[model samples]
Target: MIKNIIFDFGDVFINLDKQATYKELAKLGVTEVSEEMMQVYYRYEMGLITTKEFIDFYHKKFNIAKKDLINAWNAILLNFPLHRLEFLKELEKSSKYRLFLLSNTNELHISWIQNDWGNNLYQEFKNCFEQFYLSHEINLRKPNENIYEFVLGENNLLASETIFIDDTKENTDIAKNMGIHVWNINPETEDVVNLLNRKEFL
Candidate 1:
């Protein structure tokens, strides 16, 4: 039986335009992101560097303004359908399974969300989860073994009885290899509100 459920934030809860950052950056004269730059982004997501340092790196390297860099960084965020929040709240009410939010996210994007969604709405969404793990806050990220291990160890959750739902195949692949059940949802055709279709969890 599945006693715990883990969910990814972007695409699973809030919508994201995954290509928006690249597009927006291109418009700002950033034609390409080098391999080193990607590594820095990963580190930023892991909270290994401060946000100012992150913006400053791009400001110095690409000659882009800090404000523009911040704007490009946040372009990927979009709406969080209230229906999804309602569904999650319903799940929380059932109390049949422990609910968790595990997201590979950075501080700037989160700040944008807080500003966009308002603190009260953001808090309401967060309150639905028993454990909320943000990559920037925890200094860990998804698609990595240690991150999965951290969650399992911290919560004393059995890999066998936990179901992870994410929109990224890479993330789900790692969790699946760790003996956790997974659903790699397609954001275009799937509604998380239809989680009932994933019958095993019920």
Candidate 2:
């Protein structure tokens, strides 16, 4: 039986445009995504670099201002539907499973979320989870074998009894390979509110 549920924050709970950042960056003359930029991005996501260092790299390389860079960086985040929170709350209240949130997220995006949702609302969402793991804070990221191992080892969770839900197939695939169950949700048509109804959970 599945006794643990690990959820991805983006798309699984909060809505995301995914490409909005690219489009926004294009408007600021960032037409091409360079390898160095990608490396910097990955490093930023892993918390290997400071936020100021991240913004400064872009500001220095692309000649983009800090504020504009921040704006473009945060453009991907969208609204959180109330219904998803309700579903999560109901699931948490059941006490049937230990809940967790694992996301490959950076500081700017989280700051934007906190500002947009307000601390109280953000806490309301966070409080539903037994553990909240942010990639930057944790210095680990998804699709990485070590990350999966960390989550499993840290909580003493049995991979066989854990279910990880994510919108990205790559992320889910890694967990699935580790003997955990997964739902690579299609946000375009699938809603997390129908989780228990999914065949994996059933």
Candidate 3:
């Protein structure tokens, strides 16, 4: 029986245009993704660099304005459907399983979400989870075994009793390898509000 539920934030709860950031950056002359750029991004995601440093790297490398760069960086984020929150709240109220949120998110994206959703709505969503782990905040990221281990160990959760839901196969694959049940949901066709009704849980 699955007694713990772990969810990915993007696409699972909040809609995202994953290509929007790259598209917006291309407009600012960031036409190519260099290895260094990816390294910097990985570091930023792990909280190894400050937001200022992240912005500054692009500002200097692409000669893009701070405001424009910030806008491009945040373009990947879209809307958070309220229905998902309602479903999550219902799950939380049931108290049948411990809930968690684990996402590979950076500070700027999180700050933008807080600002866009307003404090009340953001807090309401957050309150549904027993532990909310953001990559930057925790210095760990998905598709990494240690992160999965950390979540399980810290919470004293059994992998066999946990179900991890994510929109990315790369992430879910790692968790699945560790013996956790997974739902590699396709956001284009599936909605998290229908979670329990899915075949895995049914």
lDDT of 3 at 138: 95
* Model 3 misplacement above 4 A: none
Clashes of 2: 0
Writing each residue's lDDT as its tens digit, candidate 1 over 1-202 gives 8999999999999999999999999998988889999999999999999998899899999898888889889999999999999999999999988999999999999999999999999999999999999999999998999999999999999999999999999999999999999999999999888876687755
Residue pairs in clash, model 3: none
Colliding residue pairs in candidate 1: none
**Best-first order by lDDT:** 3, 2, 1
Q: Which residue pairs overlap in candidate 2's backbone? A: none
Ranking by TM-score: 3, 2, 1
lDDT per model vs. reference? 0.93, 0.94, 0.95
- Model 2 misses residue 47 by how many Å? 0.6
**How many pairs collide in each candidate, listed in order?**
0, 0, 0
Please, what is the TM-score per model? Answer: 0.98, 0.98, 0.99
Better of 1 and 3 by TM-score: 3
Model 2 lDDT, residue 169, Cα: 95
Alpha carbon lDDT at 35, candidate 3: 99
Write one digit per residue (lDDT tens) for candidate 3, span 1-202.
8899999999999999999999999998889999999999999999999999999998888789999999999999999999999999999999998999999999999999999999999999999999999999999998999999999999999999999999999999999999999999999999989889866577
